[model samples]
Structure formats: C-alpha cells, structure tokens
Target: MTTALLLIDVQKAWDDPSWGVRSTPGAEANVARLLAGFRAAGRPVLHVRHASANPASPLHPDQPGHGFKPEAAPRPGEPVFTKSVHAAFLGTGLEDHLRAHGITGLVIAGITTHLCVSSTARLGANLGFAVTVVSDASSALSLDDGEGGRIPAETAHRVALAELRGQFAAVQTTDEVLAGL
Candidate 1:
C-alpha cells in the first residue's frame, strides 16, 4: 500500500504566545524528521495550510503568522492544499487528489492536535483511508476547561490521541513510524 504524508497547518501562527503554552515541544522537529523520511522514501507529501477568515486571528491570510513554518514549508512542485475550515479535506479537494492518486494510506502530522489534525484524521478514515497520526509530531495549546480551570496542553494532546486511537486512526510516535518505515 502506498502511504502519503499529510502535514496540516504547521504554521508560524502556532508560535504566537497569545495561545499560551503548547504541548509537545519537539513536535516541529519530529515533523521535520518525518518530512525528510517521506522524501527519502519517495512517498507523496501533501501540505495543508489553514487560512482563517477571521481578521483578528493570527492565521488570517493577511497576518504574517499565516505563513508556513520553515520546517514545514513545501518545496517547489509539492502540492499545498489551503483550507479555511478545520478539516483539511473540507473544500480543499484533498479527497479528490487522494482518490486520483490512488492513495489508500496516510501518515499525518502537524499543529493543534485536537483541531485540524484530529478533524483531518477522522475525515480521512471516513473516506476509507488507513490513517496514522504521529503523536510526537503534533501538538495542542493549553485550553480552557470551562470549570474555571485550565487543561494542560500535554493532557489535552494525550486525550486527543486517545480519542482517535483504534477508531479514527492508529496513533504512534514519530520514532515508531520512522522505524516501521
């Protein structure tokens, strides 16, 4: 089975301190490592960039932070799918591209574990793709617990992975995926 890498929204916006502390300090490094591995393996790579419509958001197209992070930037000729929605497949033609390319397996990595990454993984599974989410290659920012407490970003990250385990995608670390490859 041919497996492609889907890197979702690894943008500079995630570095904005306004979002608070982020989990998985090594996520970008791991993502970079995976990117290199995929390139070495000659596998297809798809980069997903989120362009938020909200002007105040750092991810807004007009904002500097909307640009891709250096480590995740696409090389010339690499396919980049831009989306405004949380799911990379939504209105992004990602599904069509995967179908046309006959890609049945996906290795996903990127920012905000519980949001775009999670959403994309779930949708990928729904579309019948065997998905693997690299845990150490993705992260989550601290979140409001809604009970006058804050959830640690790492805890939230772990929960997101736990939620996606088995059903939506197989969760693994970057090292594990690399070793398997």
Candidate 2:
C-alpha cells in the first residue's frame, strides 16, 4: 500500500531524560528500521516536531533542539510539521500536506507513547485515514519513585501497545509494519 509514515516527535526535545516520557529502549533501532523501509519503498516519511510554549524547554519553537535527531532527519522533500500541540494537525498544515500527496494511510513511529503518538493516532483515525502505531518504534519513560520502586518499562510499553491497538491505532511491531507496507 502507498502510505505515509508519520515519524511523530522523535526530536531531542523528547529525548531529554528529565521528561517522564521519552524514547523507550531500542527505540532508535526501531525507528531506524522504519526509516529504512520507507526509504526503500520511496514512501513519504514525515516528522512531527513540537514547539512547547515554555521558552526554557528545548522544544520551544525558536530552540535549535526542537528539530529531529540526526539519525532520522528529514531528507529533501520530506515533510516536517512543527506542531504547538500534541496532535500534529492541531496547529499545522500536516493534513493538507498529506492530502496533497493523496496519502490515505499512516504508519506512526516516535517518542512518548502516551502523548503525541497517542493523540495523533486518534486524530488520524478520526480523519478517516488508516493508521498503524508501530509498537517498537515508540516509547514512554519508566515510572519510578527512586526508592527502589518503579514500574517496568516493558510493562508500561505493553500497556500503551494494548491501548492503542483497538482504539487510537492498530498497534504492531516494526517488523509487522515492514511486512504490511
């Protein structure tokens, strides 16, 4: 199927360890796999970057770190959405860009499994586009009290995967996504 791969918010902003929600382990490798697939297929690989209202945060629109990481920077002609909110469509022309290319399907891969990834997945479904949430390619930070109390990252990741599967978007592993697309 000819579909756009929306690499949601895989920026240095979210990569900060201070954030409770960052890339899950192996996330870089997973994103690398998805990027490779999209490149091979000659499919559009769109990046969603957030511009937080907080001026001090690395995600501020004017901050240099608000862009994509070097590993997955958009190539020439690739679309990049600088969103002010969780959903990429909330404050950007991402929808119009997709429509212009006749993209009716989206494969999502990015950071913060519970934030931008989830929000955009719901919107993508509501917008009537077929959506797939790549399980391995997205991540949320592990919860911890630092007193030897913490929820396992894998467990939290599994929960996000289950939640997005039947609702936000169809959840699948990077390999599954590769096979489908």
Candidate 3:
C-alpha cells in the first residue's frame, strides 16, 4: 500500500504565541518531529490550511500569519490543500489528489488533536483509505468558559485518541510509524 503523509495545519496562526499557544497544547513539538521525518524520507507532504470566513481573523487567506510555519513549509513540488472546514476532504480535491498519486494509505499527523486531526482521520477511513494517526504528531488545545473553568487539553486529547484508535485509525506513535517505514 502506497502511503502519503497528511500534515495538517502546521500554520503560523496555530503556532502564534498570542492567539494559538494559549489554547494549543504540545502542537509545536509534535509537528516538528513529523516534518523532520517527512523531510528525511522525501515523502509526499500535503499541508492543509483552514480558510476562515471571518475577514479579520488570522486564518484569512491574505494574512501572512495564516500561512504554514517556516519550519514546515511545503517544498517546491508538494501539494497544498486549502479548505474552509475542519476536514481537508470537505469540498477540497485532497482525496482526488491522493488517488492521482496512487496513494492508498494515509499517514495522518497534525495539530488540534480533538478537531481537525480526528475529523480528517475518521473521514479518511470512511473514504476507504488505509489510515493511521501518529499519536505524537497531533495535539489538543484547551478550552474554557466565562467562569474561568478550563478543560485540560491533554485530558481531552487522550479521550479523543481512545475513540480514534480502533475506529478511525490505528493510534501509532511517531516511532512506531517510522520504525516500520
């Protein structure tokens, strides 16, 4: 099975100290490791960026900060999938792109463990792709209410991972995925 690595949302907006770091947990390191591996392997790396409807938001297409992080920028020949929703498959030609390249297996790795990572993995499985989620390659950001109560990002991440493992994809650590590759 030919596999492609789906590196989702390793964008500057998500890595910003002001807007993103406040909520994003352990994302920087996870993505860093994945990027390094992809580089060494010279594999296909598709960077999926989320385009927000909010004009002034950081993820706006024209925003420089909305672009991929410098460390993980797509190489000259890499494909980039831009979309408006959590799942890169929504209205995007990502699935078609994968098929065009004869990629039947998807190695998913990215930020926002409970959101985009989970969403994409589940959809990839439904779309009939062999999918595996790199456990250390994703992260969950914290959430809070007006009352100052916060939900720990790690706690939410673990719960979501448990749900994703047996259903959507295999929950393999970066080492596990790379060791066999």
Best of the two (1, 2) by TM-score: 1
lDDT agreement with native, every candidate: 0.94, 0.82, 0.79
Task: For model 1, give the 10-residue run with minimal summed lDDT.
Answer: 172-181
Write out the backbone clash pairs for model 3: 113-139
Candidates in order, TM-scores: namely 0.98, 0.87, 0.88
lDDT of 1 by residue, 3-85 (tens): 99999999999889899999999999999999999999888999999999999999999999999999999988789999999
lDDT agreement of model 3 with the native? 0.79
Question: Model 1 scores what on Cα lDDT?
Answer: 0.94
Better of 1 and 3 by TM-score: 1
Q: Tally clashes: model 2.
A: 0
**Ten-residue stretch with the least lDDT total in model 3:** 18-27
Best by TM-score: 1
